[model samples]
Target chain A: MRPGRRIAGWVFIAPALIVIGVFFLLPVLLAVGLSLTDFDIYALASLRNLQFVGLDNYLAVLRMGLFWRALGNTLYFVVVGVPLSIGAALGAALLVHSRLARCRGFFRVALFTPVVTNLIAVAVIWKYLFQTRYGIVNFVLGRFGVHPVDWLGDPHMAMPTIILFALWKNFGYAMIIVLAGLQAIPDELYEAARLDGASAWRQLRHITLPLLGPTLMTVGLLTMVGYFQLFAEPYVMTEGGPLQSTLSVLYLMYNQGFDWWNLGLASAIAFVLFVFTLAATGLLVRAGRRKGWV
Target chain B: MNRARAAAWTVNGLLAVLALVTLFPLLWMLSVSLMPQGSASTFPPPLLPAHPTLANYRTLFVAADLGRYLLNSLIVSGGITLGALVCNLLAGYAFAKLRFAGRDRVFGLLLAALVIPSQVAMMPLFLLVRELHIVDSYAGVILPALASIFGIYLVRQYARAIPDEMLEAARIDGAGELRIFLRVVLPLLKPIILTLTILTFLTAWNDFMWPLIVLTGNHHFTLPIALASLAREHNPDVEMLMAGSVVTVVPVLLLFLLLQRYYIQGLLLGSVKR
Candidate 1:
């Protein structure tokens, strides 16, 4: 309201505005410019070598077969991992939210423990645990007359193994959110359902799931966006291999950018990933609106 | 009555099994870390060490120089947390309480920019840092993370509940805005402050990709980056690797356990409140 207060407001926000503008907003704009040029190791050695090639970087990215494979790998991960993760979270939420469940606090903390641990640390633990010969997973299966499966070493099994690891590492986050949503539902609805001689299945089908539509949609959107950025798991556990089966879009970008110093190509790849993420978010939001959930 | 009792038992039994499955890997990580070197590489790998020893931990600190990386992690994460708190708190409060021209429009622009992933900015940000001559230094890792959009949004949501009447009274007494903020607003924001501190510390400590790219030298490597490089090395020493994992994971894990109430509360506030 006062002139002094108005000046004070500007001073208060100045530090944050400077940092975001210089570091985040500026780089985003620069990335677009960087993508238009052939900025590689030669350019890194000398700025004079940088050549503005227009859309050449984007065109090269689209024409590369490895880029297609990486895109396909990322899509497969999201398509498979999103539902599995949500299903696990919802199941765990229902169990923990049950009136009859005991030690609810213990179960909640135990389930959430994985979410807090460092991703690199836990991925190391998983890589050792799924080792073909000496891993506990294979050893346990061997006793049941099942042969030891090369979980990380096989081309076909690497992505699935990485998906399982992602599911385990992440389900706790959505579980906590879903639990909050579950708590918000009034008990009166279930009580009313019971008065009509409803079965447990019928009560869930008719009431709980419907009421939870928006929460599930939110969880699905967040989980899908996260899953599409699958880099660390493959980087640590499989190194994008047995046959590049687990190579994600982000991993491909990392290799192109850092490993080879192909900055322009990497910038193009980054925009491609952003475009996919935006498309997915737009689609989800539209679906939510159509269903009147948002 | 008997049917109700049976259902309760069934539910609890199922929960116990699920908890065990969920906790086993982490428990095994701790277990394998303590095993004698090479003992864990045998058939049907042992769940617990036969003769538990600190040999692996000793190697990590002594041979691998993990203590230096541990110290690096503390410095980087702590720096980012403090800096981000100051910046986000000031801006968030301004957005919620202060009046400025085009304030809402600027806030709208920041919110829209949230969709662009951090990776999109990494290459140019790297070059920018290189130009500033801060690359391969702690400042390189700490500068870009000095503020975040989510942090400001969190603080704004919490600070909105502070009553305007109290601020008006302070202004009437000739208290400057800074004095009023320091004296009145901060104490009321204690809960969100705690939530934001824990959230920022954990995220900074666990961040891998950014630190890996920026901090190129081994001396500047944070715990996660150091552990990743070590794992990728041609080392088959499983026990030692597990020990490294333990060292990397335990601090944040313990912090989460101690302040889980605040942590979970923040999680709900961040996700569901919107």
Candidate 2:
């Protein structure tokens, strides 16, 4: 290329490169450095107050009881939420894909409304719906002679309630993706199955499931990673309360970094969360490959 | 209904019922937002108000100062959209078309960087924002979001399909690179530009965590942050909270409804690798 054109190319790319390099890439590298120090409110006061602690932050995070509890809580959310979300999405996708279904566009919009709405706002609506004494949920259950359950107030129930909320808010996204996958399946395969005297259930098992393996794996991975970052729901709905049952690893990191100004510890927590997400994604990919799905 | 028809109708009926269940909370939020104060907390929570009114919405704007937060959200989201559009489009176009040394290598590096989640950089980014003295300012939120890897990738993917021969023709006619980009390239790229705009705007508008951390004062709080803090302060006022929820949710919902084809196209474009 000519010098003028080469300079133009450089100019075109320079602004984005500068911003990403400074704000994103630089901070990631500096976060590693920050994680090695004993940075806190004292360090915030004076740069001189900071002390390089050489993996002490990671060690302390691993040793802390709250860290483990937060990890467990986050794991519970991912383990329970991802499957339930994928199940709901798959069901919705199949129903929408069914020949019998009517007003497909309307159903798609209605289901997808939750995904686009502001999370904090919908979380507030859910907070009231799950209220203890006068909540609509319990009020409806009362008609069936069932007692009221403290949905968000009970330690045991808080995580479950949040899980239900997560499933509701997110399934639409997965459904859309799965729907695309469903549409890509060849009609000849289903025709061949029908000729072989296969029932609908058998068709779904033998043909649809196998065909959808890659899509479902992607859906599962995305949902699991998203669920692992469970902060906003508990933050808005329960405040990580009711004996801290709703506290997630990301939430713990937020509290440590933003609330307490323990930047080093929070950086360590963020790395741990990253590692968890990476390993989970790797495992799912490996499992999918072993089954000859990907 | 005949047997097969009955079965199909049964499936449709089941789908309708499920859709209703899915929509109930949002519909109830709208219904309750118009109810008299404290009426939503009543037993068997009224699905619709007997005497509907706009008192809660009025309270939100007048008493709770939600209008200011809405304005703040608009400013922050709008600024990010415009800035991110320029940066991502330029960089993405350059990546797709412009020949330079190490271009593919740099693009590969950017793609690899996508694996490092944004939250990992939050602590240091916060300190960096603090040092730049942009903490609690719109700049702090908007500046950091001006160049996302996903946004750049989306534009690059779209820009790659633009025929290089057209650009070469323009250049042979003595059209400078900037002129060709502005007149010829941008017109052809209009569809993807609209998709990128809507995607960036919605993401910026609905973003919570970073804005929550950066903006310290109420005057600067976005709608999500304001609504979150309001839920904490006015925990018992169900009608008011629903009004707040409605206000926060309606605009984006309307946007999605109107431009759903483009939105869904963009979503599928991002997700499915062809």
Candidate 2 displacement at residue A284 in angstroms = 0.7
Best by lDDT: 1
* Per-residue lDDT over A204-267 for candidate 1, one digit per residue giving the tens place of the 0 to 100 score: 8988888898898888888998898999999999899988899999999999999999999999
What CAPRI-style quality would you assign to candidate 2?
Answer: medium
What is the RMSD, in Å, between candidate 1 and the native fold over all Cα? Answer: 1.2
Model 1 reproduces what portion of true contacts? 0.82
Least well predicted 10-residue stretch by lDDT in candidate 1 chain B: B265-274
RMSD of each: 1.2, 1.3
After superposition, which runs of candidate 1 have C-alpha atoms over 4 Å from their true positions?
A: none
The lDDT for every candidate, in the order shown, is 0.92, 0.90
Docking class of 1: high
Tell me chain A's TM-score in each of the predictions: 0.98, 0.98
lDDT of 2 by residue, A159-241 (tens): 99999999889999999999999999999999999999999999999999999998998888778877888899999998998
Candidate 1's residue-wise lDDT over B15-77, tens digit each? Answer: 888888778998999999999889998976788888999999999999999999999999999
